[model samples]
Target chain A: LAKTTQPISMDSYEGQEVNITCSHNNIATNDYITWYQQFPSQGPRFIIQGYKTKVTNEVASLFIPADRKSSTLSLPRVSLSDTAVYYCLVGIMDSSYKLIFGSGTRLLVRP
Target chain B: EPEVTQTPSHQVTQMGQEVILRCVPISNHLYFYWYRQILGQKVEFLVSFYNNEISEKSEIFDDQFSVERPDGSNFTLKIRSTKLEDSAMYFCASSEEDISGELFFGEGSRLTVL
Candidate 1:
C-alpha cells in the first residue's frame, strides 16, 4: 500500500470548481488512485478513480500525471451539499482489496 | 442504484457484552468488507470476506471480532466482548469483480460501549 498526503482542509464557494490534490510519491505501476467522499455520519462513497491521464464520471473527475506520483479530484459547480471529507487511496488489485485511509481533505463548499 | 444497507443504525452496549452488526450488501456484489471510524479519526479497515471465508483482516480485528455470511443476503460482524475502545461507527461495503476496487458503503452502524 502506498501512503497518500492531501490538504487538511479546503474552502470553496458554490458554483465554483474545487480541485483536491493528493500526493503518493511511491505509487507503483499496478497501483490505482481512487477518491472517496464522506459526509458527516455517513459512509465513504467512491467518487472517481484513475490509473493515469484523466477519468471523468457523472459526479467528479480524476486527473493523473505521467509519473503517477500524484492525482487530483475535480468537482465542478460545487454546492453546499458537496462539503465533505475527501479521501485519496492508492491500491492494487490483490487477493484482498483492502483500502488504507488517511486524514483526507475536508472540502467545505459554502453557499 | 443498488446500495449497501446496515441494520440497527445505532447500538449501545455495556462493556463485556456481545454485539452484532448486520449488513446487506448489493445483490450482485461478491466481496464484502467492514470498516470502522473512531470519532474525529480516519476510517480504518477491519476485515474482508469472500467465498464464505475471511480473505484479509487488519490488526484491529482481534480474536474477539468475527464476521460471518450466514445466509445468501446477510453479512454480519460480531464482537464477542465489547470494550470502550470498540465504540465507533462500523461501515459495511461491497464490490463486484468487474469493479474490484470500487466499493459501495452503507450508512454505518454507530456502536457505543459504556
Candidate 2:
C-alpha cells in the first residue's frame, strides 16, 4: 500500500474546473492511481483510474506524470451537486488487494 | 447500471450483541468486500472475498468479524460481539474482476452500537 497525501478541502463554483492533486511519493511500480467520490451519506463511487500519463472518462480525467509520484483528478464544469469527498488511492491491482482510504479532499462546490 | 445492495439501511444494537449485515452484489461480479467509515473519518477496509473464501482482511477484521457467501446471490458479514467502537457505516462492494477493475459500492449499513 502506498500512502497518499491530498488537500483537506477545496472550494469551487459552478461551471469552473476543479483539479485535486494527490501525492504518493512512495508509490510502487505495480501501484495504480484510483480516485473515488463520496456524497453525503453515500458509499464511495469510482471516478477514474490510471497507471500513467492520462486517462479520460465520462465523468473525469486522471493525469499521472511519468515519475508516478503524484496524480491529479480534473473535473470539468463543476456543479453544486458535485460537492463531495474525493479519495485518492494507490495500490496494486490484484486479487488480494484492498483499498486503504485516507482523509479525503472535501470539495465544496458553491452556488 | 448494476449496483451492490445492502440490507437494514441502519441498525442499532446493544453492546456485546451479535449482528449480521447482508449484501447482494452485482450479478456478474466475482469479488466482494466490506469497508467501514467512522463518522468524519476515512473509509477503512475490513475484508475481501473471492472464489467462496477470503482473499485479504485488515487488522480491523478481528476474531469478532466473519464473512460468508451463503448462496449464489448473497454475501454477509457477522460481528459476534458489538462494541460502542463498532458504530460506523459499513459498505459492501463488488468488482467484476479482481485485477484492475472498479468496485461498485452499496448505500451502506449504518451500525450504532450502544
Candidate 3:
C-alpha cells in the first residue's frame, strides 16, 4: 500500500471550485489512484479513479500527472451539501488487496 | 442505484459479550468487506471476503473476529468477546468485481461496548 498525504482541511464557498491534492511518493506501477467522499455518519462513497492522465465523471474529476506521484480531485461549483471528508487511496486492483485509509482531507463547504 | 444494507443500526452491549453484525450486499457484487471507524478517527479495514472465504484481513481482525456468508444473500461478522475498545462504527461494503471497482457501503452498525 502506498501512503498518501493530504491537507487536513479546506474551506470553500458555494459555486467555487475546490481542488484537493494528494501526494503518494511511493506509488507502485500497478497502483491506481482512487478518491472517496464521506459525509457525516455515512460510509465512504467512490468519487473518481484513474491510473494516469485525467478522468471525469458526473461528480468530480481526477488529474494524475505524468509522474503519477500525485493526483488532484477537482470538484466544480461546490455547494454546502458537498461538505465531507475526502480520501485518496493508492493500491492495486486485486481481489486480495485491501483499502488502507488515512486521516483524509475534510472539505468544509460554507454557505 | 444499488446499495449495501446492514442490520442493527446501533447496538449496546457489555464487555465480554458476543455480538453479530449482518449485511446484505448488492445482488451482483462478488466481493465483500468489513471496516470500522472510531469516533473522529480514520476508517480501518478489518477483512475482505470472496468466493465464500476470506481473501485478506488486517491485524485487528484477531481470533475474536470472524466472518461468514451463511447463505447467498447475507454476510455476517461475529465478535466473540467485546471490549470497550470495540466501540466504533462498523461498515459493510461490496464491490462488483475487485478492489479496483467501486465499493458500495452500508450505513454502518454503530457498536457501543461498555
Global Cα RMSD, each model: 2.4, 2.2, 2.3
What is the lDDT, from 0 to 100, of the residue B21 in candidate 3?
A: 100
Lowest summed lDDT window (length 10), candidate 3 chain B = B95-104
Better of 2 and 3 by TM-score: 2
lDDT of 2 by residue, B1-114 (tens): 778999989999999999999999999999999999999988888998999999889879999999999999999999999999999999999987665547889999999999
- The superposed Cα distance between candidate 3 and the true structure at residue A66, in angstroms, equals 2.7
Please name the candidate that would achieve the greatest TM-score relative to the true structure.
2
Judged by whole-model lDDT over C-alpha atoms, candidate 3 comes out at: 0.88
Per-residue lDDT of model 1, residues B16-112, tens digit only: 9999999999999999999999998888889888899998788799999999999999999999999999999999999885233688899999999
How well does model 2 score by local distance difference test?
0.89
Model 3 residue B47 lDDT score: 88
Best by lDDT: 2
What is candidate 1's lDDT per residue for A44-65, written digit by digit as tens? 9888888889999999999999
Residue B26 in candidate 1, Cα distance off native in Å: 1.0
Tell me which of candidates 2 and 3 scores higher on lDDT: 2
True contacts kept of each: 0.60, 0.60, 0.58
Listed per prediction, chain B TM-scores read: 0.97, 0.98, 0.98
